[model samples]
Target: MRLSRPLRALVVVDGTDLHHDLLGASSALRDIVLEGGVVADRAVGADRFVDPLPVTAEADVYVLYRSSTHLAPEQQAALSAAVAAGKGLVVLHSSNLFGFEEGGIDADQVAYELVGSRYVSHGDAGSEGTYTVRVRGGHPVTAHMADFVIEDEYYVIECRDDVTVLADRTTPEGGTQPIVYVREHGEGRVVYVALGHDMRAWGSPHFRQVVRQAVLWAGGVGLDAVASWSTRFPLGNGRFIGPDGGAPA
Candidate 1:
């Protein structure tokens, strides 16, 4: 369905110490939202660390892609409250590594609960390899998605059973692991994607499709709405173009 107005998304990508290309990932995320016909505003580094509470209130959906900076308890509570109050949340990749601490002290349990999963491990050292993302039928986010291959960290996560699994991958140990899922929090929606390790995943058309659909779905856009809009205006090449038909700033 075509929205009467564009949804506002606040994309946050910051970490004290990160091994992944967070800045590049953040740019890709912003582009995905924009191409999906949503308005995106990014918060990076120190800008995100300052007064995180107020920022949550301004956007309809919050997209997070951070690896290592810990949020304060109150900050975590604010995020949980925001989602509970009907704001959407899209968590990507290493953002699941939120609550763990070396000695289990000062863990951000609220954030972990909000995400509905925690990163357990990626298996072994050379585990980062090519794998297929198998789409499970019957979800708006994976409506017309096809299984695609990507080279990334095979994330092993401990997830809540309540979340609906939309897509998954097979582990080397002959097991299945969820690569994408969704859940509801109060009046809001939450989506978690285990891909996007780097450009390898980001460059995939299937990955872009999932992220775009996830953002729209989380923002309360129904399947029919998205299908209608996408049919009329396909996101060609997944590039962000301004209203004037030129590249955006």
Candidate 2:
């Protein structure tokens, strides 16, 4: 359904001494969401880990890119409660790297369950290379998207059986690996994208398109409304201009 007002998004990019470029990733994501006519705000570093805002109070949707080693129990609970109350969640990249044994954290069960998957490994030699991403048809997140190739660190994760895989890649061993997927938790909707390792993946127009649509879908915007918005503000070469012919507000 069309939203009566602009969708508010809380983009969290928090981590300590992380290998991934959190700042760059968050910047790219913010631009993508804003281009889709949504208002985006960021929570970075200590602000997110030490003192976090109430998840439900901050925005209608939560975009997470946390590569940290741990998430506090209270914070995890808050996020769980928010999503259960119908707030949307969009998890990206290493945000799924959480659990007790797998995540190296004390209390991450709630967060782990929320993400619906736990990162296991990429592959031998770090599995960083160019590969094709096949977008699965018939899903809102994969609408109008075609298979594309990208240079990234392909992740291997163990997921719950209930998630619907939207896109995937073939492993060197000729096995199917999920690249994008969605889940439903309580009254909230969740979307997880396994791409976005760094600027190389984010620079891809296809990657940006998937993420933009995922954010919109999680925020409860209907396909027709999303199409209308895309028609008005087409994302060309990752740059989007407002209707007034200036930067997006």
Candidate 3:
């Protein structure tokens, strides 16, 4: 039952953090995944802990973009089960950051195993600047994207050894780190992106293209259609809630 391209996707976001404005992120992700032609189901805040995890089980792909490091065993197993059932997974920026986990389970270990990486550290916050982002090689997820300069939060990703590196970003300190990658787990596929810490990255045309292609590719959709779609359609205007606490108009 391998998931094919343009499959249904379920997004689980952590809504507890008022500062992160995960609600805006959730809305943006829904639109973005939909724009890529995938059926997107929005699961905001605590709804992700629904009993039996019906939404995840029914979907072909699971997307997580939140900062909540706490996951009950049942919640963790549900996601694992989805992947084992041959579904796809797309892990975004904050999903890799497991800070001060409260549960007995090692949150960092769980993230790495599920997403093929975890965020160990990062540069200054709100420090947006132009950086060199390059397509490392000929990976399907990085296809149709080129090396360009973007202004956003640059993350330093620490991924597993076997994960396929797709693209990289040069840090302000002259160090290069993996920004995008994918890995295969059991019968499922996983794509992780360390970019998109804020609205700028989410709104960037190039960033959206890379993420759209990654979502499709991770879902087992052939790249030919995604590449063609990339050329025909522009990215959705996903809203980004800034740190100033004002929502975008």
Candidate 4:
């Protein structure tokens, strides 16, 4: 089964919108080509999960949405192990929604240890309205034009010392917070983007690119594959080795 393609992916969402997208019509068609993993949910989990929340090793890539970032010990161990074994992760909306500090559980313990960030307080970002998404680097995904605007929510996340931020927004109070971040824990890579609270924001070309880029990059695919794969695996946090080549699955 593995040889038929290469990688398996699961996109998990823990809110309403994310679930709608993952289980929608567009996503099924998209999965035909890319063929990875998927677990995009739009619900709120009262507690962390212990097993593979999305699927299993069958999925090498994960696209998380609107769920708590903290993982149950079992869940964290599984995901971390997958990545350490060479899996990929792509997060949207609230990979940071975890409230482990407030509600302690097995998953909370795993999450607290994994994320290492504690939530202290939250204040309004004061709605910057629709702003431009600028690429800080020359990655092909975002190299298209320059910057594009989208109606998005700028969240205030409490972070840890080891958190590596990719891009951030200027807070009204004169501080910067990362809207997108990627970190390597053990062997797996965590790519989290704080966008998608506003559904309309997905309209921007750059917005889609950011998501597509993060997904493909995590699974180790390239830009040229985006257009084709986008259609083939719309509902995914899905994966396919593409024409290139990923792990042996």
Candidates' C-alpha lDDT: 0.77, 0.76, 0.69, 0.51
- lDDT tens digits by residue: candidate 2, 1-249: 235677899788877535888888788888877777788887774244335556437688888987876677777877787788888899998888776455463467787788788788987646689999987877677775667788988799888887999999888888888999999999999999998888998877677777878888888887776554542334433333222333442
TM-score of 2: 0.85
By lDDT, the better pick of 1 and 4 is 1
Q: What is the lDDT of residue 187 in candidate 4?
A: 69
| Residue-by-residue lDDT tens digits, candidate 1, 1-249 | 347667889898867535888778888889878867888888874244336556546789988888774666666777788789898999999887754665342376777778888888887635599988888867888765557688888899889878899999988888988999999998889999999888888877677778888988999888886654432223643333212333322
Off by over 4 Å in 4: 1-7, 15-55, 68-71, 100-109, 112-122, 126-128, 139-145, 222-249
Best by lDDT: 1
Estimate the TM-score of every prediction. 0.86, 0.85, 0.82, 0.65
Give a tens-digit lDDT track for model 3, residues 1-249. 122433888877863565466877788878777777778888865345445367766777777887775655566666666676688888888776553566432744554577787666667543456786777646667765667667766576567788988888766667778878888888999998877767777787667767777778777887666544542234333332122232332
Winner on TM-score (1 vs 4): 1
Better of 1 and 3 by lDDT: 1
Candidate 4 C-alpha error for residue 7, in Å = 4.5
lDDT of model number 3: 0.69
Best-fitting candidate, scored by TM-score: 1
Local accuracy of candidate 4 as per-residue lDDT tens digits, 81-134: 566667777666555555554465444555544544433334465643555454
- Kindly give the stretch of ten consecutive residues in candidate 1 with the minimal lDDT sum: 240-249
